[model samples]
Structures are given as structure tokens and as C-alpha cells.
Target chain A: EFDQIHNYFSLNPLYRASEMRKDTAGLQAAKNNMSTKFVLFSDQKPFLLRSEEPSRKYKFAVFNINQLGTELLERGTVIFLGLETWDPDSNAWFAVDIKEELSDIGPKFFPEGKYATPFPVTMQMEPTQAGIFAEAHSVLCWLDKYKFCSTCGSATKIAEGGYKRVCQNWECSSNKGVQNTCYPRVDPSLIMLVVSPDKKDCLLGRQKRFPPKMYSCLAGFMEPGECLEDTCRREVEEESGIKVGRVDYHSSQPWPFPAVLMLGCIAYARTSALKVDTSELEEARWFSRAEVAQMLAGQHPHGLYVPPGEAIAHQLIKSWVASSFSNL
Target chain B: EFDQIHNYFSLNPLYRASEMRKDTAGLQAAKNNMSTKFVLFSDQKPFLLRSEEPSRKYKFAVFNINQLGTELLERGTVIFLGLETWDPDSNAWFAVDIKEELSDIGPKFFPEGKYATPFPVTMQMEPTQAGIFAEAHSVLCWLDKYKFCSTCGSATKIAEGGYKRVCQNWECSSNKGVQNTCYPRVDPSLIMLVVSPDKKDCLLGRQKRFPPKMYSCLAGFMEPGECLEDTCRREVEEESGIKVGRVDYHSSQPWPFPAVLMLGCIAYARTSALKVDTSELEEARWFSRAEVAQMLAGQHPHGLYVPPGEAIAHQLIKSWVASSFSNL
Candidate 1:
């Protein structure tokens, strides 16, 4: 049986009525519906509500249409997230990116709400809510960065309920056929756990930007004309000088840190030599199974640790420790 | 044992010396080396040399450094492909896109060479040469479209051996940490063969643009915050009104029809009913295993056919037919 891993940003709850995107009137009706909810963002930060309990956790702060005034609604880019439920009368969910100048409006709407970055907030929230936050933040970031059309340096307008951007220049090549250039760009990246030849050890690397003593799976973006397997072998060889033999798919995660799909895999190394690329990594070394277990349990002698459970890297390491490497 | 399918455009022969990309002097020396060869493109079409045999097959028309004048080299965007072999003294390979006005120069360099669209040429070339053409075309297409920075509207300068385009504006956020926006964009798409609940039949769909009677698997560009599984389920439901229950990874292919990595899968359908979305698909229906086999053999009663062997769809269908559904 293939046991799929549902990572932090993977458990989305919305129905994503994709066919309804072209129905502008239906979207507008949903936006004006009394039961509709809106997730607000300011400067790409989500407006989250703090729990009153001792844990002080955060949850998505959603507002009704009335809570957002006409001025705010008009100024912000509202994306139709989808229906909250599959029922025809179910509430619709939308995400709007409020301007930085209107950052105080979030507090006005929800007195206990504050805008915060996705990192700690996503880790703290429920998986379903985190998934929603991921979708909203990724779409908003794409919208912010893609103001001008890549084909023609012309201002583009939001279309298809924020799912697409259309260049105003009618004669632009992007406006011709598939309009693929107008869609939100999602960069596919490979993140893998590299097992040694003996299968007793796994390779991990830490970048200069990583937290002290923290190391995780080696990863890089998927380049053109390369499959997931090619990416795995190439990235492993480039980063740690390890030659990979067999690559198996584990699971995938939608990393909304500016729209990336993390394709996770287990790559068996043909060679164990570690020649770390200093430009890409601070250090790369082989970690034995026992040491990995200790790191996961936060009992490592060197104060070493992996990423949190929310990251696919942690799941990859955990799976490696649990499996015999042959099955995976 | 897991058998890998090496589809056309997947078998790249070059040794991509990624580490040396940053060494400008070294790249220059490799470019000017006597053994270095260059692939030429005009208006996004590859220059091909037709074979003298009856097959009239085409191969990549490569040019040495001397054949390309300084004026033409300066006018075109030169991309270092990689070394022809892993040996230190091996020849280097590069790709350059010539201006439309300079199309006549290709014939001058090689009288037998002709610039043609990648479709027929790619289908007719050797698999290794086709892979090179896929890479060169994808990269050149990216360079052509991404003249302006997505983050900032400023005209960008080529960097990192055509792998990156840096915004000239120092204030642009893309210039800071990581410089992710500067990298070439490769969109991840899902192409899946949907099997029926009983596993006796499979679903196929045809877009209006597809050749008459040619049915292929359902595909869609993955949206933000969606795992491969989620994309499979959503795209299947949206395109054919079939709810996918379990999605299994088959393999992947790099389709350079403007830079897409096709993630191929076999999805088990929970619902067998079909309600085709006309806007997306011209028609969709379930074909029994016998019918699929006939179609693959080009013996379908209605002259129906599947995609060619070079496509991942063909591989997915072939695997399904060869293995018991449980094993796949």
C-alpha cells in the first residue's frame, strides 16, 4: 500500500470550484452573499486571530462581506477561494489582499486579530487553515510580483476571479493562444532524503542561512527538460558529490513560500563521498540511522535537529528511520 | 525491479557542468575552444540537417565557433549547454538564438540546414538529439519571453549562463536573498491516465486542438497549494467529472512546448460517470482495455489513436496494459 504523507500545506479543505471561475456573475454573487467569508492579507501577511487559551495559538481571522467596506473591497484584489462546503447554499470563501495603508482595518474588523508572517503562524494553526493560508498567500504573492506582463511590459488586469492575469495589450503574444504566461507561476522543486550505499546512513546538508545546527534534505528547483529523477540525481551530485542510483517518489508538498511544489523522494546513493559545494551549502555529511533518531528526538549530543513536522524534510527523515529503505 | 521508461527528450547526453557555470572565464574558454559546437535557433525554430538516406530523418545542425561570426554571436543570446562528454578534454556544446533577419545565415553556414519548428523536427530526430533540442528550445523560449523582470518592470540582464536573468534595478526585491525570480521558470503539470472503478476500462479525453480522433490523458497545470495527488483529483473531476480515489506515480517527461514538466500518473476513479466540461474538452469517454489495446496498435475500428511513443501518455497506457491494475 502506498501511504501518502499529507504535509502542512497539503490538507486544503476548499472545494476549488474551478469551472465556476469563468462565471464572473456567480463569483460576484458569492462575494456579496451574507454567508461569504473573507481572509484578509496586508503586505502579504495574513490577519490571524490569537486564541485566548494558555497555548495562545493562532487561527485564520475571517470576516463577512459587510465587515469589509466598499472602499477596501474595491482597492484590494479579491480571489475566490471556493465554496466552504459542497452544498449549493454553502458559504463561499474569498481571500483579499488589503493594502498596507489599510493594515489597521484588520484590527478594526477583529479587535483580537494581528497580521503576521506565514512561518510560525502556519506551524501553529490547524492543517486545514494552514492550507488555506498557503493558497491565499501564494496567489497574493504571484499577483503582486506579476503586475506587468512578462511577454509585453504592459499592466495586466485580474481575470477569471484572480486565477488569471490578462495583458491589456491585445496584440501581445501572450494574449494569443493558451495564455499560459498569464497564469500563476508555480516552481516545482525536488527535496530528497539520500540514503548511503550500505543503507545505514543518510545524507543531509545545511546552508549558511539555516538555523544553527539544523540540517535537512538537499533540494533544488527543477530545471527545463529534466524529470523528477534527473533533478534528484543532478541536485544530489551537485550539492554533496553523491551519485544517486535509484530514486523513488515519497510524497509532495505545496510550499507557498512564493509558490513552489516540493516533490519529495528517497534517492539511494551509489557513492558516499561528500564533496560539499561551498557556494550552495555550509556543510554536508552522512548521518547514521541512530544519530538521525537521536536528532529527531532532540537528544543529539551536538544539539543537532531536523526541521519541524510541518516540513516535508522531517517527514522524509521520519519515514527513512521507520522503513528498511528497501520498501520505500 | 522498477523499470524506467526513457522517453524521447528524456535521454540527455550532455554532462551539465553546473559548478562551472559561475566561472565566467572558464565558460568563455570552453565557448572559444576548438572542439566547441553550437546549436542555432531562429524564431524559436531549431536548425536541422536532413539525412541523405531514404528516411530523410533530421539531426541537430551544429556549428563550430569559427562558423559563427562575431557580429552574429554578439546579436544572439548564447547559452552554454554542457560538455559533450565527461572527459576533461571533451568538446563543449552551446545554443544560440539568431535574429529573424539573420535567418539566411543558417543556410550560409550549412547549405543543407533549414530552420523548422520543433514539433516535426523533434519527432524525426534521434532521441539524444531530440533531448538537446528540447533543452535549447525551452531555454531560448524562456529568454525570449522574460526580457523584463517579473518582480520589477525593468529590463533584466542575462546572468548565470542563460540560466538566470537579473533585474537591473538595484531596489528590486528579486535582486536580494536567493534571487529566485531571476531563474528560468519551469511549470509543473499533471498528465494522468484515469482508470475506472472496476479497472476494466480507462478514461480518455480530447481537446479541440488535438488531432482528429487522437485521445490522450487528462492534464492541467497544478495550482498553488496543491500536491500532485490533489492536482490529479481536482483536474480529473473538473475535466471529466470523475472523482479520483487513489493516484499512483508512473513516471515524468519534460515537454518543451514552452517549458513544462509532465508528471505522469495512474489515477483510480471513484466515479465512472463522465460529464465533459466542453470548454476544456471536446469529448471524454471510457474505453475498455480491449479498445485501448486496439487503439495503441492503430487497429481501432474508428481509426482512433493514442499519442505517439515519445509522449508520456503512451508510456502510461502501455504500462497499464502490461501490468495487473493491483501491481501498478
Candidate 2:
């Protein structure tokens, strides 16, 4: 099942030439290239070029140098995402910006409501576009909120080609070793598809924020003193009364609902009991393997639907079901 | 070899009992118990009950509630770091504080210089003590720095039994779902022992900050939008120009020199070449299995030494050597 869940967000068609980011000459050259592409966001919504026909799939309204000629660029922060390897050999650098400059200029260029789209809608586009959107959205979101230093009240300056922020106060501890204040942040979270001892059923839970009849895997942030395995076990036992034995890493997805790295896993449970923690989850129950397969296929008798392809939860459930069915 | 590398820091001899954290009454009752222990810190250094004789090992200078007398307790913060099950079923809630309230009073109660020891020195103590120290140190370090909210720059308030911080601003986004701003921080890092295709030699690197001839496994922070396996491969290649194939998780250690989860792994490299990134590492080279074994045994012929048993890198090398030797 390697790369079975391909085309998810963050699986971009770009080579993040991170090693070359520090080279000012190389970055400058790539940025000024004619093939260089720019994507704009307004209030977290991406300015995408959509097809006129409703039946056609969505596409990103990616802008080139002529489309966003150097005007009012200072009003917004620009992040150098990476060089697009769409052809796997091209040297075109792609950057993204979330600024009022684009919001004002976008309406004059593309039709209103047709150009700007939220992140969730972008999932309908090609995988490369969605991945680019995730990279831009997450970095822009972090910049918007983290304008001030957490250690001190001093404002920070963007460095390392928008990949890092440094506090202006030279005396602050953030200025010292490793520069903790700098770097883009990613909250690591564990999401597991817990299987029963008999392997015929799996545990699923739903939070209050989840849609009606939609259940997903148990998840929580990886805490300070715990490993990935222990985090999965603890979160499972906390949300539901299942005692997990062995945990196997499945896949990973970059969830940009404010920057999260979703580590998906397949957990083996020793106990099949249910003692739901209502505070953490609204409902938790064991679904038979057959029923889970139905849910994944969107033919559940009860109309219980799982999340779409954009979510790691969907992939986790789908992968497990496919493997189990093949064994049968 | 499941718990072969046991008795390391952050490997506690007790359950965290996190489900009971919100139970204020239970916590209050546990705090006043005679068996409940208090480990105090001064400036991030833990206070231990050192032996008068040089031959005896160090111990944590834990004080009970009856010993503190409840006077001047308000000057510092206290965090409950689970229970110690060393005495079988005896319940003892262990708490730690890093306040100066003990700096003046600690010497009066215990032997001079014996009660206040730095963090690295505490590694000489029992695993349970070291684990407790890690918990307290990580939580206190976070609280010490995160006094103000990064989102709004407003002062925050402690909530959820010192596990979370809430912004005072009502309209702040921290007040919304999930409360991202209010959690203990843990930076995830990957540390891997890369082995050659022939399995006879392994790669090691040394930073400028490291002691002379002390080469450990390569490590780097797990960046956002990347998985643990990818982090290992990327970091290894970036630091030493070694292209890795399969990456296997070995173990994890909570390195709380300000809260970092060091995930140890065993990497299988496709190529055994070294093109060291001089900026990231001072030196990197391939060491034969015989040399690594000598370093682990603290009897290297060239006077080179690996980190002691305290570091995950040492354990990783030791585990690989043992496994490889068995194959012979």
C-alpha cells in the first residue's frame, strides 16, 4: 500500500530546494524567472482561477510575473515555498502571499467569487495545486498570528527567506543557540485506526464538531514525555476504553487547519470494551470490518459517511479495509 | 530486548494517570498525603539528596508536604508528575518546583552543595527520579517562557491543572476550538544510527558544540510537513550526503533541555559516502562496527568516546552492535 494514499495535501510536485534557500543569488535568480509562479491568498482564502463550466474540476488561479507585477507587494508577506518540479526538471521557483494587495487587484482581474476559494474547496483541484495551497496557507497562517515574540514582547523579523523569524532583541534568549523563536511550527498529532483482538471490528469516534453520522479515528497531540506508540495507546484508552497493544505507523499528512502533522497508524487492541470519555468525544463505538468497508465505499446502510480523500482518517480506514479484504 | 535500554530518563516506574488530572479533589487530597514527595529546583537544576561518601550514588532530595510546612508555597508553581510505584501499591503524588524559596532554605535542611545539583548530574540517579525531573523541568521551562500569548501578546492564565494556558483576551482565537495556544511544547527530533549496506560500518557526526572526539548519531528537528522517516532521510543526506533506504524506529527519549522528544531510529543507507555539510556539522565519518563497539565500551583505541548511557545515540549504537554481533 505504499503511496496508495497519494495526491493528498503536502505531497507537492515541487522540490523544496531547502539546501539552496540560504544562497541569496540562487533564490534571487529563481524568483525573477519568467516561469516563476505566484499564488495569492486573501483572509486565508486562496485566489484560484476556476473553470467557467461548473462540470469542470477546480484549478488554482496561479499568477505569473506579468499578472502580479511589482505593486503593493510590501503590504503582504511573501513566502518562498519551493521550486516547482512539475516537469521534474524545471527550475521555476514558486512563492505564495496572503496580502490585501492581491485582494484589491484580484477582483479587477478575475470575476468576483469565481477566483477566491477557501482551502477545503481547493481539495477538488489537482494534487499539486492542493499541496501548494497547503504550503502557502500554513506558512501564511503562522505569520499572521505569530507577529510578536513569545519569550519577549518584541516584534520579530522574517529571515531565511521567510522560513524563519528572529527577534529584534539581541539580548533575548531566542537570539541564542538554535534560535527557538525561529522556524515554522507543526503540531504533531497521532490518529490511529484501532482494530479488535479478533480483527473483525475497529474502534471509531466522533467529536461534536464532526458532521452528522461521520466518525473518524481517535486522535490527540503527542505530549512532551511520550513516544508515538505511547501517544496512540494513551489517546485511544482516554477517548475509548480500548487497551492497545502494538502500534504500527501507516502514513502521514500535513493538515493545515492551522498547521498540524497528522501521523496515521494502525493499532492492535487487546480489549474490546467501550467506556467513552464524553468530554473528549461525543460518541465512540466498535464498527464491524464489513460496516467500515461500507462506510468507506459510501454505501453504508445507515448512511454513515467518513471524511473525503483530503483527510488522513479516510486513507487510514480505506487502507485497512482493503488489506483486510484482500486477506479474506 | 523490549526494555533492554530501561532506566533511562523519562522512563517512569509509574502510570501518568492523566485521566484523573481534572479531578481537583483527588489532586488536593494527594498533595497533602505524607507519602507525597516534592522535588525542588533552583535555576533549572534539580535538588538531590547526595551521599556523604563519594562511593554512594546520588538520590533526589524529595521533601514531603509535612517537611515544607506550607509556608511561602505561593512564590512558585507546582506540577503533579504522576505517582511512584516503586513501593508496590503505595500511592505517592510527586510534584516539582524550581523556586528560590528553596535556595536559602534547602541548605538549612540538607547538606551544603549536595541538595542542589544540575540536570546532567541527576542522570546519575535512578530512572524514576530522572523521569520526574524531566517532567518538572519541561513544564516549568514552558511556563517560565510562555507568560504572554503569542497570538495577541496578552498575559495568559493557567488552566487544566497547569497543563494549559489561556489568553486573557476574550476575542482571542485561543478561546476557540482545540485551544492550540494552551499546551505544553515538545519539539519532535529524529536521531538515527545509519548503517552501511554491508552492515559493517555506521555513520556518525559531531557538531562544533560537542566535546572533542565525541561523535554521536546525526539528529535534526522534524520539520513541519514532513514525516519521521522523511526527516531521518533528509537530515542524514543534508548533514552527511548519505542516501538512506529503509528507516526503522528504535526507541524514543524525552530530552527536556527545554522539552524535546528525541525519536531514535535505525537507518539503512544505500550509499556510504560522506559529503559533510560543514555548516551543520564539524565532522562526519564512517565508523566500523568494531570501532563503535569499542566506543560504547568506553575503551576506544584512539581515545574517541561516544556519549554515555544517558544519550539515545549511545543506546542506538549499542542495540545495533548487539543485533549485528548476534547475526555473526
Candidate 3:
């Protein structure tokens, strides 16, 4: 039952053929195939097609290799997303960063296409499409940021079909051994719904950047040498001064605002004191079960609300309420 | 009860006062304090003291600021780890990379000290000391590798008391806004024990690097846009050609051999196949409960054995045997 919690951007349909990444000839043949589809990104913003038939929705604006010119195809960073199916004739999907060539080729290929920031655009797309967008965005952004090696400050060349980068300098430490520094980095973060000792209330906090009347679960990036449970407890105590006891894993979501995995958990708190760390949160307090239900249903008297249904925080709160805070 | 699994190098006792990291004056005073203890690392090797009175044991060879000497301290890359207690008069702790100054100061301050690689030495120390070494080793190694900014090929200066590094160039993109590239990175990996559909056996694999007759759980680093469950299933199938379904979270451990948070899980196999991917594993096979018990007890007729108690793999195996493959 817990594994059924599939948040938005979590249901990827592509078959990531990781073993085929090292086969340069196979990759080249796939790219040359006419059935291959390409998703385009410009400055981390995705290109979409607006649909107004049944209701307002967005679809990824995919193109063929021939549609994108040779120069754009060669110069842009192309990442093989995966195959739609495992069959030999299956459509090979890919994502390309068209930022440098967008100005020159935007009007020619996708004159009617609309580009928007990942968050808003992903919210309107279907679940599978959103998942694909998450993967593409994270990989493309990582490529843009890591043009040079962190080990020796030397330029690197992409390898393993965009899955890895290798330093050009032979003396770089990353080339000396089986180092993961050249791979796409994914930060694991903790997001928890903390229940009070008596189980009557759950703790929620609002960041300065959040909407005025919205509060969600507390989240922070995990540090080196700390387990997920330790991260959960530390984030709760540091941001809201709530001490957590037993932590239960709920589910996980891939938040690709530059690649982070949100580990959702239900933490039982031992202390009820509210000492908001001003530097981290604008306000933090416990909400009763009734108040939380109202917030989730958009019926809060003060117009307060939790995060949207697509967010893992929303699922955590909903799960806690559904279980009546038992057996968690 | 799952939280009781305190694996080796997982129980850090230091109170990480993260809020005080930005206060330069506070950090300076803490560093200059006489009671502050320093842990020294030379080329990622930790210095330790040997105790031969009773059973042979190893302890962290810690020194105060005065004993470390100002020249060595000034030239070395020092990191403020944490405090022993939250009290104002509590002792502060720090870890310093003495690679450059080790040759000059090694004979003077620690002539009797013995240095060894982290893995062998950690196996001999107490749990608390091993946990501290985990933290120190991970952070120091991270700092050594990240001498330059990943965003731009420019020199970087340490900030946030060794928790972060900022690019020196003002034009660097990392300086423009909040970026996690500056912080210490901890990769999240999935390690799992797979149970057969009939629940009569468990799957295990051994890489070429592993010792002879030793098979452990399958594990691989989580890629972007992948949840821990997805990672577990993918790694299992890829390494062993055995499909997995209905994954359950077990526990987590911080394996600080270059910083990784191991997310442990118990996965159920949907199919029982024996096609091993030779590139990732030398061999994989299903082991009966009796064989596993014999291996755990070191009584296998073939002389096969499981990992030691300090490893999470051993814990997973022990738990599975204790539960009779029922609820888990």
C-alpha cells in the first residue's frame, strides 16, 4: 500500500537501457533512426504544445532528428532518454539542450511552440510526460553546470552516452580510479510529517518563499555520514525545535529542481514545544487533525492550505490523516 | 525496533551546531579554546593510538590547538566538526587535513602515533570513535577533491566552516544564487536482499572485487529521477536478471568511504532466473535459508561466509533469518 504513492513526475515510462550506454555504435544507430523522438530544452525551460480540446493541458513538443538541423544536432548536448519499448524497432527517445541554438533555430522549427519554466509546465503535463521532463531537466542542468572537472579544474568530455563525463587531463584524480565525481549528482533530502506524542496534531512549517497561507512538511538536504532517519530528526529539530522519536518511511519523489530525491517519512515527535528557528522558517506550528483536514480540502477558515496534490508533502499529510495516525 | 540497527560508523555523537557555522568570531573562539580536540588526517589516513593492556583496541589520537602548533594549523585545511555537548563550556571538535604539514610536524607532535587507512583502523576502534572518523574522513576527502568550483574552472575558498566552498570568481554562476554544488555531496545508493516469490530462498551476488566464497546483497547508486524502490528493482534485475516486486524499506546506513548514504531494502523477486550480468557481477545465485544460516555461523561445508556484524549486509541477512521471511 505504501508503494502505491506515486507522486507527479514519478512514473517514468522510458526503459533506461543503462547497459547500452557504452555502445557508441548502438547509440549512433539509434540517433540516426527516423523513429527517434527528441525533447528540446532551452535554458532548462521545456518546450510544450498547448492543448485546449477537453481542458487546458500541455504536451511535450517532440521533434525528429531531421527536423533539427545538423549543426544544432551536433553542437547541442544530446542525452539518450531511453527506448519507448525494449524491442529493436522501438522508438528511441532523447533530450537535447538547445539553449545556444535556440535563437537561431527556434522560429524555423517550432514557430508555434511555447517554452515555459519546468515547474509550471510540468504541473500541466501528464504524469508520464512530467516524469520524462524531470529526468531530462536534471541531466541537462547537470551538464551545463559541470563543463569543467572539480578535481583538477580541467575541461571534460561527455562519455557513456551522456550518462558520464571524463576529465580531459590525464593527471586528474577522477581518472585515476572508479570515481563517481563525473556522474550526474542527485542530492537526497528528507521531507517529514511530524505527529505529536498524543497524535492529536501534526507539525508543519512555512518558509519565507512559500505562499502566504500555505505550509508544508519540513525538508532539508542530508549531509555526509548521516542516515535518512538522522536527517529527518535533525531537520525537524533545527527548523521547528520538535524532537522526533520513531521515523517510518512512507514513499519517495524525484524533485528535479536540479536533481533531488525527496524521502518522505512519518516521524513521531517526543516533544511538543514550538521554538521556530527564525533563520529557517517564517512560522511553524502544530495543526489539529480537523484543521489539517480543512486545509487539505481547501476549507480552512483562514484560506490556509497544504502543498498541492502532486507534492510528496501533500501525500504525507493525507496518509497521516487517512491512517488516523495509527500503524505508521 | 528497525531504528535500533546502529551499524558501524553510523552513531555520531557530536552536536552539529549548524547555525553557528556562519559566525566567524564564534568559530574562531571555539578553535582557539584549549579544550577543543583535533583529529588529524594525512592523505585520508587517520592517526590512532594503540591500547595493548587488555584486548587490543584502537583510539583516535586527538590533540589540542597548542600541541598542533600554529604553523601546522595555519597551513592545513581545518574543519569544525561539532561540539561534545550543547553547554557553553563544552568541548569543541575539529578535523584537519595535515597532508602538507604531516611530514614537518609528524615527528614532533605524534612520533608514537600510528597511521592507517580508514577501513582497517575503523574496524578496530569503538563505535563512537569510528562514527567520528566516518564524519571526518568523508568531509576531508570531499574538501581535497573539490579544490576548484564545478560551475566554473576557478579556484574556490572554503566557507561555512568546511561545510561549503565558494567560487572566487565573482562572475561564476554559483555566486549568483543558492546552489548545492558548494556543499558536501552524499550520494544515495540502494542495497537490497531479494527474497524468492515462494519465500524459500534469498538472492545474493558477488563481484570480482569481493573475496572468494562471499556473496552479499545487490546494490547500485540511485540515478536521477529514480526513487529508492525503483533503484532497488532496477539494480536487482540488471545485476541478476531477477525481476523484483513489492519492495519494503528496512534501514539505512552511512558508509563514508567517500560519502554515501546506503538505503537498505528487502525486495521480493517476481521471477527466479539465474542470468548474471558478468560486467556487474561475477556470479549470482539463490541461497536456501539453511545455507545462509550455515554461512552466517561460519559452518558452511564449502567454507562460505557472510560479512561481519558491523556491515549492514550482515544485519539484513540476520533480520531476514530472524523473521522467517514472514512480515518483511
State which candidate, 1 or 2, has the greater DockQ.
1
Q: What's model 2's overall lDDT? A: 0.74
Off by over 4 Å in 3: A1-3, A52-56, A103-110, A326-328, B1-3, B51-56, B100-110, B326-328
TM-score of each model, in listed order: 0.96, 0.88, 0.96
Best-performing candidate as measured by lDDT:
1
Please list the residue runs of candidate 2 whose C-alpha ends up more than 4 Å from where it truly belongs after superposition.
Answer: A1-7, A19-30, A51-57, A85-94, A100-102, A107-119, A322-328, B1-7, B19-30, B51-57, B83-94, B112-119, B197-200, B323-328
- Put down candidate 2 lDDT per residue, B138-228, tens digits, no spaces: 8777777777777777888766556778888989887887645678877778899999878888898899989898989999987655667
Candidate 1, CAPRI quality class derived from DockQ: medium
**Per-residue alpha-carbon lDDT of candidate 1 for residues A1-328, written as tens digits (9 for 90 to 100):** 4455678898889988877788999998888888898999987899999865444377888888888976788899889888876665788899989889988888997888888977766677778888898888899889988888777778889988888999889999988887567898899999999999889999999999899999999999888988899889889998998999889999999999889999999999999888999998999999989999999999999999999898999999999998855522
Structural RMSD, model 1: 2.2
Top candidate, metric DockQ: 3
- lDDT (Cα, tens digit) per residue for candidate 2, span A100-157: 5457666556664354555567667676677777777777777777777777757888
For residue B215, model 3's alpha carbon misses the true position, in angstroms, by: 1.0
User: Higher DockQ: candidate 2 or 3?
Assistant: 3
Per candidate, the number of residue pairs that clash is 0, 3, 0
lDDT of 2 at B132: 69
Could you tell me how far off, in angstroms, the CA of residue B177 lies in candidate 3 after the best superposition? 1.1
